[model samples]
Target: MRALFRGLSPFNVTRRLYRWTMKAVRRAVEHFRRSLRLQLITTFVFCLLAALLAATLAHGMTETLYKRPYVDYTLSMQRMDWETRHLATIIRDQSETDISALQPMLDNFEQDVGLRMLLVNLDGKVLLKSAKATESQVDLYSVISRAMELRLDLNVFHPQEFVAFYPVELAGQKGYLIARGMPEANIRYESTGVNMISVPVFLVVLIYLFYRFTRRKTGYIEELADSLLVISQGKLDHRVEVRGEDELGSLARNINRMAQDLQENIERERQAEKTKNELITNVSHDLRTPLTSVLGYLRLLKDHPAGGLEQQEYTRIAYEKAEHLKRLVEDLFEYTTLSGQGVQLYRQTICMNELVEQLVEEYVPLAEEQQLSFCKALPDERLYVSVDPEKFVRVLENLFSNAIKYGKKPGSIGVTLAREADGIRLSVANRADEMAPEALNRLFERFYRVEQSRSRKTGGSGLGLAIVKSIVELHGGSIKADYRDGVLSFHIWLPVPGS
Candidate 1:
C-alpha cells in the first residue's frame, strides 16, 4: 500500500520519470563514448563531409576569380559581333550614299562602348576608321572573303584581341565592317596550372584530416600493447592509460585489475608458504621437547629394573609429559580443522549467563591452584545467544587457562559478561606482565607466543588462542586483546539473537 501511494504521488512519479530519462540519456552517451565501431564510422562521415565542403569552396573560388572574366568576355564579343553586323547591313543599304555620314555615328559608338570600328572597300583599303582604330590592324578583304566563303554574315576572331567581321557592299562591291574590343584577360589560362595542383592538394588535406582524427586511437592501442607486454614479463605494477570509455579503455582497466589481483595472490601465496615453514619449525621444536622427556623417563624406567617407588615416579613423569604432548596434538588438530574452509557449526540458543558461570566455576579450581582468584561479573537477566556449545566451551577454556597461567601470583582473573546495544560482550581480563602493542596484536595468530621460552615452560603449544579465535569467528563472533597498565584483557563479542 505504501509502495502504491508512493507510485501515485505526483512528486514521486515526476522524480522517478526524470531519473529514468536521465539514466537513459546517460546510457546513450556512455554507449557513444565507448563504441569503437561507432566512433570510426562517425569520423569517416565527418571527414567525408569536410572534404566535400572544402572542394565546394575551392570550386566556387575558382569559378568566381578565374572563370568569370572569360565568360563575360565571350558574351561581350558576341554583342560586338551583332553590332558590327548591323553596321555592315546599314552600309549595304546605303552603298551609293555618302558613307562618311556613318563616320560620326561610328565614332560616337566607339567612344561610348570602348571599341574600334573600321569600314573597308573591296580593295582592302580602310575607307573609314574610329579614333581608337589607329592602333588596330585588319585584313578586311580577306576577312570578308572568308566570311563569304563560309556563308557567314557575322564572324568573331581571337588572336591578341577580340575582333568581329561582317560582310557588306560598298560602291556595289564586296567589303566588310570590323569591330575590335578590349584584349582578353588570361586568368583562366593561368589558373590551369593551379587547377592541376589543386586536386593533389585537396587529397593531401583530406588525408591529413583523417590522420589527425585516427592517430589518437592508434597511438592508444600501441601504448596498451606495450603495457601488456611489460605486464606479461612479470611487471604486474605496470598499467595502461585509459583514454576513453571505449572498448580499448575497458580492456586496459580489465588488464590492470587482473594484474593487481595476481600481484595480491602471489603475495598471499608467499605469506602462506612462510607461515607453513614457521609452523613446521615451531611444531617440530614443541613436539620434540615433550617427546624427548617422555622417552627419557621411559628409558630410565627400562634401564633400572627396580620395580619400586622410583619406577612409579618415572612412570608418573612420563605419563604427565605424554599427557601434555597429547593435549598439544589435540590443540593443533582442532586449530587446523577450525582454520579450514566450510567448518560446520552446531548452533543452539543458550543462556549466555549460565554458560559463563559454569565455565568460570569449572576453571575456579585451576585458577586457585595457580594462586589466582576469580572476579566474575555476569548479568542477572538470562541473556540468550545462538552458538555451538562445544566451541563456546573451548573459547572460554582457552581464555581462562591463559589468564590463570599468565596472571601474576595472588592476582585475580576478572570475567565479565554484559549486554551491549549491538551484541553480548564477554571479557576475561587479568593482571599479568604488561605486553607490547605488537604482541597484543599477534595474540590470536596461529603458533604465536609473546615469550617463546615462557610459553614452553607453561607447556603451551601457542595454538590455544588461535583455535579459540577461529571457533569464535566461525560462530559469527569476534575477539580482541587489549593491554592497559599491568592488565592484559581478551574481549569477545558475540551477536545476540536477532542483533
Candidate 2:
C-alpha cells in the first residue's frame, strides 16, 4: 500500500514529468546546436520572425503617425459639414447674395478649425473670403465644381491646399461655400525613408550574429583537424578537447582513446624488441660455452688416442657437453613454440591424483640421491582435469627438477594435490633459502634466475619456468610461487572439467 501510494503521489508524478520535459528540451537544444539542417531552419525562422516584427511595428507606426491623424481630421470635417449646411440654409433664408455679413463668423470658425472659407457665385466671382485668403488670386468656381462632381466629403486635394466645399441655395440661386486648409506634412514619406534605412541595417546585424554563432559552434571541427595532423606526425599524446555531449564530442573522445591505444602498442613493441635482443645475447653465450667445452674434449681425444683412460675420460666429457647442449637447444625450441601464436594443445582427461603420485615416485630416487627427503599428500578421491598429457607432464617435471636442484640439502620436498570448488590446486614445495621479492616476482620471466651461478651449475637454460607458465596458461590454468618459513612453494590451479 505504501509503494502504491508513493507511485501515485502528485510529487512523484510532477518530478517525473519535469525530468521528461527537461530531457526532451535538452535533446531539442542539442539537435538545434549540432545538426546543420536544424541550425539552418532555426536561422530562417529567427530571420522571418524578426522581419515580421519589424513590418508589424512599421505598420503600427504608419497608422499612428499618418493614417490615424488623417482619419481624425476627416471625422472633424464631417462634423463641421452639418454646421456649414445649417449656415448655408440661414444665408438662403435671409436672401443674401454676398456672405460678407457672416464673414466674422466664418473667420472665427476658420481660425478655430484651421481652415479658410470662400463663397463663390454662378458667374465664378468670389463674394466673401475668410481671414488670410485675400492673398489667393485663384478662382474657386472650377475647383468647387470639380469637388462637388466627385462628391468628396473630406480631403479634397488641389495644387496648393486641401479643400472641402458645400453647395447651397441663396436667394433662389445656386452658389458654393468652400473651406480650404494647407496640407499636413506628409508622414508616410518620412516613414518610408525610415523603413528603407532600418530594414537593411537589421538584416546586416542578424547576418553578422548568425555568422559568429555558427563559427563558434563549428570551431570544434577545426580543432579536430589540427589534432589529427598532430597524430599523423607521430604525436600520439595529443588529444582533441571535448566540449559537449554531442557527436563531435564523442568523436573527440574516441580519437583520444585511439591515441592512447596507439601509444601503448608502440611501447609494447619497444619492450618486445629489447627482450628479443636480450634473448639473442643470452642464447649466443650459452651455446658458445657448451660448444667450446665439447670442442676441447674432442681435441684432447684426437691428440691422445693411445692413452686409454684419458681417451675414455675425454669421450665421457664430450658426451656430457653434447647432452647439455641438446637439452639447452630443446628447451629453447619448446619455449619459442609455446610463446608463438601457433602452439596447439591435444587435450585429454586424466586423474590428477595418479599423475602426481607417479611424478613423485619417479623423482623420489633423485631426491634421495641428493640426501633430500620426499613427501606427498594426495586426496583419495580422484581429481580429474583436462590437459595435454605430454605438456602437463613436462610442467610437473620442470617443477620437480627445480626443487631437486635448488632445494636445501637434507631438507624435505613435499607435493600436494587437492580439489577446490572452482578447480584443483596442486602445490610443489621444498625447503630452500628465502629469495628476494624482486626475484620471486620475475621467476617466470624468460632467462630469469634467482641465482645466476647456481643456474650454470644445474645446467638450467633459464627457460624452464617460462615454458611451464606458457603451457599452464595455454590450458587455461594459472601458476604462482610463494616462499614462507624457508620453504619455496609453486602453486598451480587448473580448472576442472566443464568448469
Candidate 3:
C-alpha cells in the first residue's frame, strides 16, 4: 500500500495523467475538426455556461435537503436536553407506583427510539441508564468537515419554524419545554455520486453531438473521394449522386461534367482511327491493280521465243516479284476503301431464299470446273430483310470466291443462309488446313497473311475478308471467322427490321 501510494503521488501521477489527457483531447479534437464545419470555441463556451447553471442548482438542492425540518437537522445537545426533561416527567410522576417502574419504562423507551437514555445527578454521576452503550458513529465529524471546506457554520443550524412541546408533571415541579429542530440531513457521495459529473453536463452533450456530426461529414467526404478515383480511371460513364446544393454536391456535378466531356473525346478518337484505317486500305488497292497488269505484260515478254534463255529466266523472275508487289498494293487499297466508307443502304426488302438459290446455281459450275462439290443449306422459308441489294450480292460473291480459292482440290464447299433471332446468319465454309487462332484474330486487317491458305497460291488479295467486314458493318451488322476440323468458315449477322 505504501509503494502504491508513492507511485500515485500527485506530483508524479497527476501531472502525467493531465498531460496524457490533454494530448488525447487535442488529437481527438483535431480528428473531429477535419470532419466539422463548426467551431469548438462555441461549444466550449456553451458547456461552461451549462456547468455554472447546473452547479448552482445542485448547491441549492443540497442546501435545501440539509435545512428540511423533517430531517431534524439541529445540533444533538438541544435534542438530548428536551428528551431528558421528557423522561424525567415519566420518572417523577405523581401518579401511583411511577418511581418503581421508571427504570423499566426508560429501557422500553430506549428500545423503541434507539437512543441511549441517561439521568445524571447534579455532581455529574450517572444516576440511571437504559441503553447498553453510547453512539460512536456520530454525524458531527462529517458536518464539521464540509463546514470547514465550504467555509460555513453548518453545526450552528437555524431552528425550524415547527416545534414539538412536552408537558411534564413531576412531584414538586411543573415545567413546559418546546423542542425545535432535530439532526442535520446527510448528503453522501456514495448515494449521489452521479451529481459530481453533472457539473460538466454540457461538455458531454457537446462531445456527443460533435462525434455524430463528424462521423456523418467524414463518411460523405470519403465517398466523394472514392468516386473521384473511379472517374480518374477512365470510367466516364460513372456519376455521383448529389447530396444537396452544398459544396460536396457542387464538386460532384463538376466531376460528372468532366466525365461527360472525356467520354465524348474518346468516341471522337475511335472514329478518327476508323477513318485512318479506311484511307490506308483504299491507297493500297489503287496502287496494286495497275502494278498487277504491268507485271503480267512483263511475264508475256519473258515467255517469248524471241528472248534469250538466261535473260528470259531473269525476266520471268522479275515478273513474278512484280506480281507479288501488285497483290500487296491491291490488298492495301481494298482494306482502305472498306474502312473509310460509311453505310449507304440501297435498302430493299428482298427474298433471301431465291437469292441464295440463284447465286448457288451460278457458282456451282465454277466449283465443278475445279473438281470440287458445292453444297448449300439455305433457309426454305422465303426469308426477307432490308438490304442494299447490290452490296449484298458482292458480299456473297466475295465469300464464295474465298471458299473456292482455299478449298482442297475435289473437296466440298458449303454456303448457308439462316434466319436468326435478331437477324440473318450467312455462313460460307471450305475445307482447308487448321487455321491459326491468332490469324483469326487479325483476319480483317489489310494484307494480314497467314502461312497456310494466305499464300499467293490461294490467290487472295488478303482484303476480301476485310471488305466483307466493312460491308457487313455498314449494314449495321458484324462478321466473324472460325477455323475448325479443316473447315475455314466465315459467319455474318445482319439485323432484321424489328431487331
Candidate 4:
C-alpha cells in the first residue's frame, strides 16, 4: 500500500523529468556523434561519480563546522563547576530553611549567565526553577520526579545527572536540583552554515562542467597537436589518438610504429660507427710499428761516422725501440680482434689453483723487486674451474700487474680463494690510493686511468683491464670491486670446474 502511494508521489515525477532531460541531451549530440554514446556515457558516469563524492565530502565538512561551537559551549560550562562547588559548601553550613537559602544564588547565576535554572526534589520532583530565558525553558518538575522515582536512594555522594550539582537535604520528603542554558545557545541553534551542504559541490562541478563545455569540441584536436609535437622531437613512438574508429587512432598507430623502426635503425647505425672506429684504431697501431722501424733505420743511415761503436750503440737502441713498438702493435691487433669480433670460448677443465700458482710465481719476483708483500691463500682442495686457458692466463696477468702497480709500498697483496654456490670467487685484495667506487667500473674502458703521471710510470697502454673484461665475459664469469675498510678488493668469480 505504501509502494502504491510512492508511485503517485511527486518524487517519481522528478525522476521522470530527469530521464526526459537526459534523452534530449542524447538526441542533441547526434550531429557530432561518431561513436557519440561512448563519449557521452564516459563523461556522464565520471561526472556523476565526482558529484556524489563531492556531496559526501561537503556533508562531512558541514557536520564538523556545525558541531564545533555547540561542543565549545559544553566545554565552557566546565569552568562554572567552581560556582556549583561553592553552593554545595553554603548549603552544608546553613541551618535555616528560608527562601534566602535559594533566591540570592538562583538570581545571581540566572541573571549573570543568562542560563535557565531549575531545582528538583528528592522524590524525583521539581522544588525550584529560575526565571531566565523563559523562551527555551523546559518544564521538568514531574519529569524529574519520575526520574528520581525510578532511581530511588539518591544520596549526595551518589547524585544523578542534573541533581548531582544540586546539594540537597530530603526535607522529610524531597531533594532539590537545577539546570541551565545560556542565551548564546539560541545563536548556535539558528546557524545558516549547515544549510550550505551542497554549496562546495555546486562550485566544483560548476567549474568542471564549464571546462568540459568550453573545451569539449576541441579536446581531440588538442591531443592530436600534442602527439605531433612529441613526434617532431624524435619520439616517433607517439600516437595520434583516435579513441574510436575516427581518423586519429589509426594515424597514431601508424606514426608510433614508424617511430619504433626509426629508433631501431638509429641504434644499428651507431653500432656500425663503433665498429668502424675500432677498425681504424687497430690499423693505426699496425702501421705505427713498421713506421717506427722505417724511421729508425733511416735515422741510423743519416748518422755521421756510421761504422763506429757509437753507431753500433745507436743501432742497438733503435732495434730495442722497434721491438717494443712491434709488441704494442701486436697487442693492439689481438685486443681489437677479440673485443670487436665476439669470440666464443673454447672452455676446458682447468685447475684454478695451478693457474694462480703460475701467475703468482711470475709476479712474486716482481713484487719482491718493488718491496711488496705478495701472498696467496689457495683452497686446500683442488680449485678447478672450466675456462679458456689463454684467456684465463690473461685475466691472471692483468690482475697481477694491477696489484703490483697500485699496491702501496710494503703493503700486502693478498689472494684469497673460496667456493661459491655456482662458481669459485678468487679475490685479489690490495690497498689502493683512495679510489672511489664510481670510477672503478670505468676502469675496464679504453684509455681510462686513475692518475696520468702514475699510469705513465707504470707503463700501461690502458688496454690491460679492458681486455680482462672482454675475456671474462667471453668465458662466462663476472668481476667486481669490493672496497671497504681501506682495502681495495678486486673479486673474480669463475664457474666451478665442469658444469
Per-prediction backbone clash count: 0, 0, 15, 12
* Stretches of candidate 1 exceeding 4 Å from the true structure: 1-306
Listed in order, each prediction's TM-score against the native is 0.46, 0.46, 0.49, 0.48
TM-score: which is higher, 2 or 4?
4
Backbone-clash count (model 4) = 12
The 0-to-1 C-alpha lDDT of every candidate, in the order given, reads 0.78, 0.76, 0.66, 0.67
Lowest summed lDDT across 10 adjacent residues in model 1 is found at 185-194
The residue-by-residue lDDT of candidate 2 on 1-499, one tens digit each, is 9999989899999999999999999988878666656766687677667766665665566543442221224344455555566666666676655445678877887787667777776655677778777733446656767556534545433324455666766656676777666544332222223335346545765676567666856687888988999998999989788877556777889999999999999989978965874585468566767677776767666666656787677676766767677677778767866876567899999999998889888999999999987788998899999999999999999999999999999888899988877899999999888789898999999988877784567548889999999999999999999888888999999999988
Candidate 3 stretches greater than 4 Å from native = 1-327, 341-343, 436-442, 452-455, 458-461
Q: Give the top-scoring candidate (TM-score).
A: 3
Tens-digit per-residue lDDT, 158-225, candidate 4: 22233224555533433544544431211233354564767668668856864685374468667777
Candidate 2's displacement at residue 98, Å, is 53
